[model samples]
Target: MAWQLHYTSARRGPTGRAGFQFVAETPGLPDGVRAGVTPYLSYRPPPDAPPSPDDSELGLFPVSLLYDRVDGRPLLLRCSYLGRDYSGRYGNFFAHAVVAEPDELEGVRPAELWHAPHWTHRPEPETPVLESLDELVPGAALDPEALAAWLSASGPGDPYALLGRLVDAVAGVLGRGHGRVVLVADDVELVARWIAVVSYSLPVAAAARLSFVTYTADPDGAAQRLVGTTPAIWASAQHHASHASAFDLRKGVRDGDASRFARTVAGCWRGPDLAGLDALGELAPLNDPAQEAAAALLALCRGDATVTAAEEGAAAELLSRRGPGIPEWVWRDLVPGVPSMGLDLALALHERARAAGAAEVARQCSLRVTEGVSDALAGASALAEIAAAAGVAGRAGVPVDPAEVSAAAARCARRGGGDLGAALAGCPGGSRDALLDGVVAGLAGARERERAAVLTPGNCDLLYAHAGRLRAVPVIACAVLASVGRRRPGHRIPVTGELLRLDGETGGEVDAALGEVWSEPPSAGECADLLDAHGDAMARRPALAELPSRTFTRLAFPGGDGLTEPAALRLAERVREVMPGGRAGRDAALVRAYGKAITAGPAGAARALADLADADGATPQLAGEAFVGAARRLCPRPPAFRAELLAALSPSARARLGARWTAELPGRARAGRAPLRGAEVGQRNELVEVVLRLRERGVTEPALEAWARAAATRWLAAKQLDVHLARSPRLRASLRDLLGDGPPSRGGR
Candidate 1:
């Protein structure tokens, strides 16, 4: 009996782009088995063609001949398009012989076989499904028997497993050369089966040896024509449908949720296992406010925390304890976060500190008011807040002792010793004008006796501590002196000069009188003189002078050029013994001075300058100037020495003395004059030679222009006849223009 492959196409609706159905004629042989001996062909004409089934046929010779022997046994026949015909002779005829039960062959009932020789068949047409074996058998398949047998002697178990084993065998054969193996199957299920079987059979070590798998579709005769007509068969095939399954599997692995099979494979490979956080309670205690505040305060002390939540918490706690009053240290911490801390928070802190009776804290808060002033000075937005705080603190009855405050201020000043001169120099007005109000405030409550005592040697420490702030010194000193003088108008505290002039006669008496009110002698000069004298006294004071030499140096000469000759010499001597050579700027200045002095003349001022320069090479400009002055002075008496002076010029000096060379040449030419009987040949020759040399030496443009103009005029007059023989066109034209067409005259001669 003849058999037929009968199955309904899966009813994926008209909206469905493609559909697939597995014809299971046999059961229990595995899901992939299709066993049949019967083979028939049926064709639907191209959708645009006439609706006639007679146009297509399946015939005897190739199909029926193979089927007759294989009857009752299962056979797998792949039917695909051969262009216009379904005859086996026209296209590729693929038939697999196999064994199956009668039930496996039941649905495959025999259809009519066309045995005619008159019909012509077309060559095999291309179909997306049959193009690559991967489409028929996906890489994720479970059964790889047919594929493995095709690739090697090993019968199929799993495609990847067989692939890995085959790879090792090949590697051994070729000593590890690279290659590829392609497996063709009937459908995607077969491919998936291959991959599944191979992957399951092989150990992880073997599985890793297998590298790549590619899938492709196999199309039937119907699919071939329909392919180019709509969306192609490859895109609308079982292989393509299987891609969703493969993609989902791959995505799940990437997202850490692999298929059970893949998980097993991965587990066997012993790859890294990542697990999520389980115990987050270990970091709980850090969230406590008080602890955080204490930590922040500690961090502030260590300079680790700044203007943060922790710092704010600490500030709040400190303000609560000290009322609104906060110490300078707290302010230092708060300053960076000032804007964020808000004006209300700052004011609240200050008021709270004041209420807590913390005077030191209150003082600290008031000091922060100065910070607002500084910010205002810096042009910050918070200046208004700072000004308001300063006003409030000033009126808060804070009883800040000026002396005590001054002492603290003095300490702050000492910390910025180098900055004192700059601060004083840039003071708004003169120091006297600057601190007059502060001085008046300081003197307001003091008695005359107290003021006198305050101005005496006992308070000298305070005055000396702030010596650099000359702005404060004069006003304070005047107030103290005026107060003391007012109290005892007739008091004659013998001055030191008076005592010294008296030769010890009134020394003890003056000392005793001064001690009566702890007063000092009145100076001969008035307040200005006293201030000058006070400055002199401060300068001469041993302790102030005993500061580090660098401090003195900075105070005396802030810039490199500010150093005087003596100072430069002193620094050079000191540095030479201490520092290495090749130090530029100050050090080079000294070296240049020393060199200049060595070359200067003995009778000239250059000698003194040279001596000063050579002593330590200080102030090279001075040495150079002195050398020039001395050269000018000695030039008339010792004219020959002029060459030596010119030779002695530094590169810079050479450039400066450039104009002098031309100026002196004429003087040298006119040195020996003669009666105006004829041109002085020797002098004229000398002038010509000098001019030639000047031109050769690349003299400057202006000097050259002047010299050239003079030479042209003189030449024309001296050699009026030679002017006709002038070789230079420019010179000839100029001479002709100046003298016209004149013969040699007496002046010309």
Candidate 2:
């Protein structure tokens, strides 16, 4: 049946005047087919207006249609009231309405008949499916250019580089738009690959938002699940699918629902499977043996095993064909348990081939072994031995070169039980000491017992046990002298003493040797002794003088609460003793010592200093110095101290302290005295007044002001200043400063 729907253009107002009228159409309806219409007002008209008609008889305006004859097509009809209309003739009306056919509706299903206007229109376009990207830009063709560009531009201004922008844009467009755009295969792959890349590479905050979108878009996709299931994302989500879900997964897993986490991992593994493999490989080194073995096996299953069957077979065939004695034990021992057995087997085969007079087989095996053992310790040792033998034959009688000895020792150090050390030890007379020195130098810092064992007498005996060279005679004689002297207590020979006792320039050589062994800065005790016994020498060494004050302070303070008072008193004494010149030097030393003490424990040391300041012979100068030092150490740039110091003095010191102190006082005092109580109002007020006046004059010494404010606040809050400044104008000024200027004209009562 063709239906024509009528719509009112306007409604009745409070005055009871009729408004307007309009018409809408139901799709599949002929041009003149008539259907009754009704007005659905968002709010009802006033009681003075005319009574309304029954809603059932009038029918709903702009309603959807279900046609029994048509398999898929359905129509939507809408009607609205536009203002007052006087005519009822057959006039053309300009109105806004939506008419949709079923197949043309976006996101609409064809099974049932009814339709709505909200559905998006699905356009028929010929474009490649996303999966076709594999064939189009396979493998390396999809390069890192886009990724590098995105990463390079990832800072603030370029939002497109941010994963958040991409995620939000994708979500907004997908959720809001009614039309679809055709994406090229490259674009599809880029999007998919970019999602994978961002899941791993983006910063945590941006990645988190992107991960949410990915999971929300397709919960079943492997890549999405992997990104969602990562420890970082899972922790961020509070271990729940939804905000209301349980955070602890043990309950679910205990109830046999481990599938949730497991399936998430599996999903991640499924999407971009090779990327997953790469991740596994990257994490492999951190895994334990069992995990490594499992990962290696899995890698093998994934077709990335380092050793293959063809390589293994060739090694075995070569060994069988060209061995003097192909030991079955080699196969049973080294080959079976190892992961890269084929490579090791090939090297063994090459060794056998070389001994069996098979030149071609030997050459191939040698090449294979060389490639296989590039980083192996055994290979390095073998290479070093070959180089050393070649070196000795080319230049005989002269001492083996120090560089050759060093190289041979290093190879031996890397692989224990190798005889490089012995070979270097057996150099001809001229080269013996140089070679031994090389071995000792190489072995000096080595942690292994085997490397250090090269220095023992047995190894030295092999090189110089018989007829030692004249140069070697001194070394062997020295060792023998050292050994024999061990039998005597007071008669033991001293290497440095013996060198120094020699005549003429021989003493200079001893001095040089001693200098190499006993380099400077001495030790902490040596520095202390130097200061005690030879202060002049210490004064000459400027670097020693600049040692952190804490180093000396630590010696004075030692440990525990009981030591604080004594430490402070001792430190003051030390400062007086060492820094004897100007007040600036003494003051600097006091500040340094006080800083060390405070860092040792602020409350304890501060209390101790306070106690010391109150002691019997504590002159005001010393007391002031102590207080200033402690104050500076504790709050070096505190505004309250500056303010109080300014306040405690007249305008002269305030002027002297300058604009820095004045400008910083209010802010610093406010911050420093935040923990002080209201009881300190009077003294605090006085301090604040001084600080504000200073600030007005433009002094900004934060350290002095902070100290002054804190001391004054403590004193006044303790009721020490109530009688002194109860009725002062400075107090009023301080209060005004504290409260800030009165609220703006529009604010408060």
Candidate 3:
């Protein structure tokens, strides 16, 4: 019964026209089978499934079995689909039918079964089962020529190397070494050993047969999952399973928990399991405790200073030493100051001063924050300046004597409202997780929902206008220097989440670096000084000009809200200066700062668009493309800004864009050359999108549209076209919808 094929080829619905059919066109088959069979459908349940109806108690299902002929006997392929696409609405999702040649087939499970066995003891569906590949490829023999061809074609690593090792290991175990074999287990470690043993030999294939069974992956497939490696490889690879586990937190280095796991399992990977590989399947991941600590520390550094390349490298260098995870006690102590004012931080400082006869620990934490900032003078202190509220400069912003600072602190002790000193008095220790959560939430909150202070007396008050979600200064100030900086040519440096071995000798250097990173004590004098400078800058700028964007740590709306063309361009320059060395971090910060900076007024934003249109930086992939999106999100009149920007292109850019692309199209196509790229390409694409958007608003300028169309035409007409744009059917539809362009009739990019 298990081996028998069950398929229904045709069925009709309430309307005769609503019919279904599946007719196999196989050759050399007997007429014993009937044609035009009834349809069979596996049911799919909605996401919010209700209780089964009475008729659904017995459920409806569909299945197709697979077989191969051997010695005139039908050998069951036992192929099954292991998963389903959960993309669309529930039901058969017939729109996405899955049927292909056996070799090309991926196993997918049937849709949801409405009924379950009344008995609770029934085996739950989709649990991994051990199976043998030998049964499918029995009495295996290899063609030496074919084997040689395959081996020569295969690379020495990854997919190819792993396959070779696995086959070799299996062949060795079968006593057919240097010959043929194939490769599974439930005991993870033991199974890993079994796989390792097979790696020493290789296998040969004679002929292949393919069949498929369908299985939909349940959302919780990991509930009782097992390794998909077959029984043969698992048995063979057992020889090479033992080695030191990679740095286990439980047992530490020499224990070899992960190394054993990898050599046993990963190193033994042969091919997809006979039961079918679940594309959606996931392996339970292991981690190195030290790497986790470094990641947390990286997040800490990004909190305050706009993380820069130098700072990032320094922090990475600190972590690469791998002396230790930031002790759990460190987090426990730091959490209090992170979300609230550093009351507990100060208390700890005082206590440590008494107990250790020094205040180095708290001093280190303070120093970490100060050293991260590359430009202390330029950094703003909104909290300090605003709280000080002195006309030209806030209280903290003035160059008062140290006596005046002490007097102010005493007054803060009494009033205790928004004052920094008052907030720090008796610092509270909040839950560690809560503090961590707040820090994370604050990370990307710099540019969020624009709560435009429309009703405010002064519309240009950028501070209150673009005021971001408030977080304690300490939360931003406290940082962790992740110092695992290693650079090898052609190797990309990882930003976070990596665990590499640290030379044991560097432990002292690691500690010293960590100490230096956090060594500076919090100085009220310095913070006040920063605020004073910021206030002075703010006071000099007219209140009616721009959003009050200057802050204690960094300038927000730099060059005032009515930013000049140079200042607008300098925004990208500022982004370039504060890049995180890594492209991803830099792009995110660039987009974020760009969005925040342009939100104040349309005057500066228009010029910013021009600068961004000609942007050059670390993230050429995003280029000026993202600035368009960021500006749109923050701009009050995006369409108008676009229109204004289109009216003025930099001379070089305008000439390059409106030149002979169309006239040279034929020759360019013959030569398979692209028309434009880099800044020009990005700017061109941006113009097209903006023009399309403007057209949507019942507006169209002939020159603007012509320019945009020509740019789009050149991009589409490029001889060596990008595959994504080339193959996209929706490209025409999108153009028609957005810009009302007809389909390209001939060769294209």
What's the lDDT for all of these models? 0.32, 0.35, 0.29
Return the number of clashes found in candidate 1: 46
Writing each residue's lDDT as its tens digit, candidate 1 over 360-468 gives 6555655554454333323422212222333333444332233433332233322222222333333333222222233233433445554444354423333333433
Give per-residue CA lDDT, model 2, range 1-749, as digits (tens).
22223333333422345443333333445332222112221122112222332435222211211111122322322222221234432211122222223334322221111122222122111211111001111133223344444444443343222333233333333234321111111112233343444333322222222222111111122211121122233343343343222111111112122211122223223342435433332322221222223233333323444534443444444345435433333323332223444444555544554565656655564444444433332343642443443233223212234465445545554344335444544434454444444444444345567544543445434333322331222333333223333333232223223322334333344334333322332323433343454344323233334321323333333222212355444443443566443442343344444445355453345344444334342233443444444443433434344444444433443343333323323453444444345434443444445555556555544654555444444433324333444566665455345334662122111
After TM-score superposition, the amount by which residue 98's alpha carbon in candidate 3 deviates from its true location, in angstroms, is: 42
Candidate 3 lDDT by residue in tens digits, 1-749 = 11112221123322333223222222333343222111222323322233332335213222222222333333322121112223322232221122222332122111111011111111112321212221122111122223334433433234333443343233232332122221122222222222222221111111111111121112112111111222333334435533111111111122122221222232223332211111001111112222222323333322433333443333333333332432333333433333322222223222333244334544443333223211221232321322222111111122222232233322322232132322222212221122122222333232222111111123112111122211222111111112211211111112011111123344343334323322331122322232233323322222200111211012213222222234433433433343233442344354444554356454455454444455544344343444434443442244345544434545443233223222222443223344654444444444455555555554555555565554445445422222323554444344455435555434444
How high is the lDDT of residue 26 in model 1?
24
Model with the higher lDDT, candidate 1 or 3:
1
* Model 3 ranges with Cα > 4 A deviation: 1-222, 231-358, 368-749
Better of 1 and 2 by lDDT: 2
Per-candidate TM-score against the hidden true structure: 0.20, 0.21, 0.16
Weakest ten-residue segment in model 3 by summed lDDT: 276-285
Model 1, poorest ten-residue lDDT window?
A: 275-284
